[model samples]
Target: MFWGDLHVHTAYSLDAYGFGTLRTPAEAYRFAKGDAVGSPAGDVQLDRPLDFMAVTDHAEWLDLMYTCTDPRMSAHPYCVKLRNQSTQETGGTVFRDFVNPTITQAQPAKADVCTDDPSACDDALLSQWERMQQQTNAANDPCTFTALNGFEWSATPNYSHTHRNIIFAGDNVTPTPVDYIRFPEIDQLYSQLEAGCRAEDGCDAITIAHNMNMGDGKSFDVETESERTLALRTRYERLVEITQEKGTSECLPDYTHRESLGECGYETYITSHSRQKPLADFEEEEWERMRSSYARGLLRRGLLTYANRQDAEGNPLQVGFIGSTDSHTGLGGYVEEDQWQGTVFGIGNFERNMSRMGFNPGGLVAVWAEQNTREGIFSALKNRETYATSGPRIALRFDAAKVGEVPACKAGGALAPIAGGTPMGSTLPEASKAAVFRIAVTGDKAPLEKIEIIKGTLKGESYEESVIPVWQSDKGEANACVIWSDTEFEPAAPTYWYARVTEVPTPRWSSYICQEAGRCEEFPDADVKIQEHAWASPIWHLPTR
Candidate 1:
């Protein structure tokens, strides 16, 4: 398996530039290639070179920053104002007043810069996009380091985080990125992608939804838009980012009946950019936020949707899980806690301090692929053969099949008795007697704590889940493996199973911050430590016909 980070931002993104990252796409690719790069905090480099990386800067302001700074654009008055405001030391003033409003209100800036004849601005945007593609082409080294041409569709409607990173398969990409300004709704974005990329012969793209935790209740809404059918959604959106700098989108303790599961609350930050109320303080209406925003809840919804009606087009509502750094400082796969850098740069020490306290080192996406090239990695992602890790380079595999069939299982591969059985991101075949699930995990930095098989089934109209401890280690073993059979498996109800492997307790980013600030004893809340973990994509068992 090869590890890579699919979502990262560079200075071309207005917010990233305002926050202090001055690195271009070339510089970001250079940094991911194991070269030293300078950030606002200091010079930084990845501990190791990533197999693949994508510089997915925000599409909203794809070339706005460069347009403002270019002296040749002095004829545009608003460009001068933007350039001047960006240099202000007020810390995110430009973003707060100008950019954030555009996203939150779904109102594009109609200033003279591009309001009347948008062609000039569109030309500049195309130029920037070409530059980014050129950088990617220059940086890509087949079988060594892969540079993916991608961009973030910043669709923060009403300040609700409905963001997605659009990654293309190869160099044959759209001339320009599809931004949320022109395509505000997620469905519209998908339609644009299909029309632009999928319609092409060799070009294709996949949209991975991220930061669903801050989506109010709209991120995983089962209600289809006028244009977005279930088939279209399943066809385009193949993966969901379960963990990132914002927090883990896996599950919340308060949201589920399985509150006893100790690991459900790892690095949860739903209250960060939202109403700022803690999960314990959530009101009755507020509780619905977690239900729609979490990955587990979304998976349950997927099962319920699939059970109600099988996709006529054969595109089921299964979405795999992956983790990304979501690092705005142009750092990809830089998730080491001790070597952490703030996400934004121009912010004062106060914001930087808060970043260190609240933010994590970020997460990584692992792909079971044949090589390190773009084709190899993109194919693995397309097939949903992927796993997510909370910083550590943990290795994990989950598979299930009948007792007699060969154990030809891999994450996201399907196995059905009628068809064989199902792997992660697939619907399982009907079982006669029982089904055997095999799970294996190997830790990187810390020893293994335990391995759990999390099963979620739709009970009536609601969802019921259980975290079954398949394997445990008392002595902190470096590896844990298990093969268990569900003899009491019910073929009447649809079910899904995924493995969660946890490492021994280690100091969190918050703990390191507190210790360095000399307040480890005083601030108990800041001294939080956690067991880093990885989550395998789920394998599903459809109801036996």
Candidate 2:
């Protein structure tokens, strides 16, 4: 399977400055092609190249970094006069605020192209946008690389958290992103984009929600914090990023206090590198303290829905998960050995240092697709046939049926059962009084080991559950299958089930190489004793009456 890091930032993003590498659109594409870290001008290369990369720099002050750099643009007498500092430092002043400046500061200072005229903004901005698009298209060589046009929409509702990354599939067409839409609310942005796409042809876009842990307890809510019923959320947001370079979005210890130990403490949210009151600060161990609360919240919201009646549409708001590295550096440096080369902090530069550059080589995105092409990859993401990793591409397959049931599907052959079976993230209908879950575990060709199935239930008003060791396949085959039955399931138990496939302990990238071996020595603090391979089944909930 081919690998792709869907979320990334470029120099166009204000905060990306001095974070080791500051790459332009063209430079970002080259960095991906070489599978390397650092800007086009820097020295490090990635251990493994990504098949595809999306330069999703922020859209708030899109391309401000480049515009401010051109003397012809920034040195306009009007622009120079408005600045308290020297004209050369205007860019830093505009972007370096403790909190990003609002849109009022976005207009040109003069009256003409060279004199701070609003039209000048168009000249510099439009050229930069085209440059970004051209570079993305230039890097698309199907056999080796795919470059996607994407940008992050910063939507902090009343300064709370509600950010999303918007990505596009085809480079053939694009909208002349308007200035009035600058920093609009998330719902409005979604409406604008959806309307724009329908006006054109073959334009497909998807938004991935991120940094939600910082949403102050409202990121995953069914309704907007303002009590607005955002019907478009169900239509626009197709997936949730559950893991990233800074932390994992899986259940936190405190959120899942009842079943908090095993997979709870893996990692937390990505605090920005700046020490000046991190843009979004919270206690380091907050994940532990908030785990149970979060899970309870999820259950509370989920249970409110009735058995048959749905939302405005016949469909329910499906809460599915996927993972990605919110890497400021263009590469998603997920592997420990390659972490130093793939992330921003890994760049050997002292002057560009920031506290948030506290590097942790964590997380990757995995999808179950028919092939490694653009269409196939996009389909997996849209259908939620994807899983995130703390960084190993472990293969996991799961199916549920009655105790005596066996699928006719197999991985090989023209009409093999694999083609007819449901993979992880799929629901199994009730076949009998009890459901017998079957799973197949395969290590990332690294090691074979054990598997876990995390189950939850609502006993009336309270929810109870357990992570059962359903499958314990040996380290014998390249892959192994396990069958287990839970005849004890009560007919009245309000239940939901999911699987976690894991690999046997294996050598981490650090274990195989040391500093003297011309590689970074210590595995990142973010690196944990990972079992290489893991699979998470979709939370199969029976239904709420």
Best by lDDT: 1
- Listing every candidate in turn, what is its Cα RMSD in Å to the true structure after a full C-alpha superposition? 3.8, 6.0
lDDT of 1 by residue, 171-190 (tens): 98876899888888777887
> Tens-digit lDDT track for model 2 on 1-545?
45667777766655554342355767767766664543432556665666676777666545344455432446544334333332222434544441144322333222232443556566666766676788777887765676777777765544444567776766743464433235355656667667766635877777777655545454454533322334566566766666665555456444224333455544444322212233224454553333322332353344433233344331234445565667665554335443343345433332222233333455566666666666667666776676665566655556565334555423221221244444455544433356666565555655666667777665666666577875564743456566556666765554556666666665443333333244332334322344643445364545424
- Please provide TM-scores, in order, for all candidate models, with all chains considered together: 0.90, 0.75
Question: What stretches of model 1 exceed 4 Å from their correct place?
Answer: 70-77, 84-89, 225-228, 254-262, 311-316, 345-351, 402-422, 430-433, 459-462, 517-524, 543-545
lDDT of each: 0.74, 0.53
Best by TM-score: 1
